[model samples]
Target: MMTRYIAFLRAVNVGGRQVKMELLRALFEQAGFKQVKTYIQSGNVIFDAKGQEAALEAKIEQLLQQNLGFAVPVCIRSIAAVQAVLDNNPFPGVIPDKDFQIYIAFLQTLPGKEATAIIATLQSDIETYHLNGKEVYVLMKKNTGAPPFSNTYLEKKLKLVATTRNLATVQKVLSF
Candidate 1:
């Protein structure tokens, strides 16, 4: 049976690097995936495949490197798993558009003690982090782009591959 999966890709369309989302969907289809659909333009792809998770991830990564001409980190999560990540958000009570916004950065696994300790050190600066399984929930204040809250810093501190999107973007992606 084919299972639904979401591939969150890093560094797809950013920093003036233009990669069309349609091209991304086509790459997945060429890689033998079905029902391929891309959400927004931040490289959120949903499709169905049949195989072990590790093999699937390797296949997709290889396909990306060959087709996109660059190494793009891919995080594959089941549709159900993505839904659970959205549902289990710990900062629901906070105003969504006010001083609170959540971003779920998918990871391969929980960070080790050293990496996680480094990430914990930066938790007190206007950002709340909740590490749930292979996902990190970030609740940032009104201005996300300012101050110490950013995806680049968090990824560096945690030493893990990650891609982040606002809660609204996340919900839109899940709806597909």
Candidate 2:
């Protein structure tokens, strides 16, 4: 049976790399995905296909790399998995606003105990994180500039591939 998945692509349309949403959807459709749709320009693609998550991720990464000439990492989650993340909100009653922001880092795999320990050491007053399964919920204070840490920092520290999306974006993707 086909499964519905949201593929969160890393580094799309950022840092000099630009990917048109139309092309993205076309790529998925050409690869046999059904009902392929892209949300915004940040590489959020929702589609239906028959494959395991890991296999699907690898396939997409390969397809993008071959076409876009850069390594585009992919982290996919089923609709149910995405819903579960919202259902188990770590920061309850905390509404995101101008001063505060919430981000969810969708990881390729669950972090190990050592990685979790590293995360504990990285938490601070400005930003905090909660790890539930493969998702890392990050709460940060909006400042004059960008926050000290980012998805790249998390990937380096956790030693895993990850793609991050704002809580609002995740919710919007779900509605697609």
Candidate 3:
């Protein structure tokens, strides 16, 4: 049976790499993915395919690199898995506003114990995070400058590839 999966791609439409949503959808469709749809320019693609998440991730990474001429790391999660992240609500009663925001970092793999220890050290008063399975819920308080932590920072500390999206973006992606 085909399973619905969301592929969160890293480094798309950022820096010098720009990928049109239509082109991304086309790549997935050419790779035999059905119902392929892209949510935003940040490279969130939802589709149906028959395979395990890890294998699918690897296949997509290869496909994108071969076609786009650049390595695109992929993090695949089942539709149900994405929904569970929202259902769990790591930051309870914290309404997102201009001053406060929530971001979910979708990880390529579950972090090891040592990595989790490092994550613990990265927390602070303005920035806090909760690691739930392969997902990290980050709560940030907007201050004078850029936030202390970002997707790239977490990836470096954890030594894993991950893509982060605003909570609202994830919600909208699910709606697709």
Candidate 4:
């Protein structure tokens, strides 16, 4: 039986690596994923799969390396997971305004206790964050400066691979 999934890729179209969406879609199709659709160049892909999520993630990562000539960490989440992240807004009191944007960092796995504690120490003058399972919700206070949150910082502090997506882009992927 096939299931729908959203795959978030790390290290694509950044640090001097560029991947075209058309090629990405083709590669995913070549990997046996059906209905392969890519969102923004930030490497968001929604596809249908028959394999387990882990197997799919590994297969996608392997394909990315062979097709792109580089290793890119891939995190796959169920369609329900995205809505759950939105529903479980850590900052329920924060007004949803144009100035503030919610970016979710999807971790490679649920963080360990020690890793969670380390992430708890992250200090930000312009943003607030919540670490829950494999999802970290970041509320950025826009006019202060660019959001200081990053996938690298989270991975470094928490010992996990992660990829982030803005709320807007995330919502759009559901429709695709």
Report lDDT per candidate. Answer: 0.81, 0.92, 0.91, 0.83
Counting clashing residue pairs in each candidate, in order, gives 0, 0, 0, 0
lDDT of 3 at 92: 78
Rank by TM-score (best first):
3, 2, 4, 1
Question: Lowest summed lDDT over 10 consecutive residues: which window, candidate 1?
Answer: 142-151
Question: Per-residue alpha-carbon lDDT of model 4 for 27-125, expressed as tens digits?
Answer: 999888899889989898889889877888899988989888999899998888887877887876776476776778899888887865675677476
**Every model's TM-score:** 0.91, 0.96, 0.96, 0.91
RMSDs, each prediction?
Answer: 1.9, 1.2, 1.1, 1.8
> What clash count does candidate 1 reach?
0
RMSD of 3: 1.1
Across 1-176, the per-residue lDDT of candidate 3 in tens digits comes to 99999999998999999899999999999999999999878999999999999999999999999999999999999999999989987887988898889999999998898866887898887888888889889999887486445799999988999999989999999988
Instruction: Judge candidate 3 at residue 99 and give its lDDT.
Output: 83
* lDDT, candidate 2, 1-176, per-residue tens: 99999999999999999999999999999999999999999999999999899999999999999988999999999999999999887998889998888999999987887877887987888888988889999999888475555999999999999999999999999998
**Weakest 10 consecutive residues of candidate 3 by summed lDDT:** 141-150
Where does candidate 3 stray beyond 4 Å?
A: 146-148
Residue 98, model 3: lDDT of 81
Candidate 1 lDDT (Cα, 0 to 1): 0.81
* Model 3, C-alpha of 119: deviation from truth (Å): 1.5
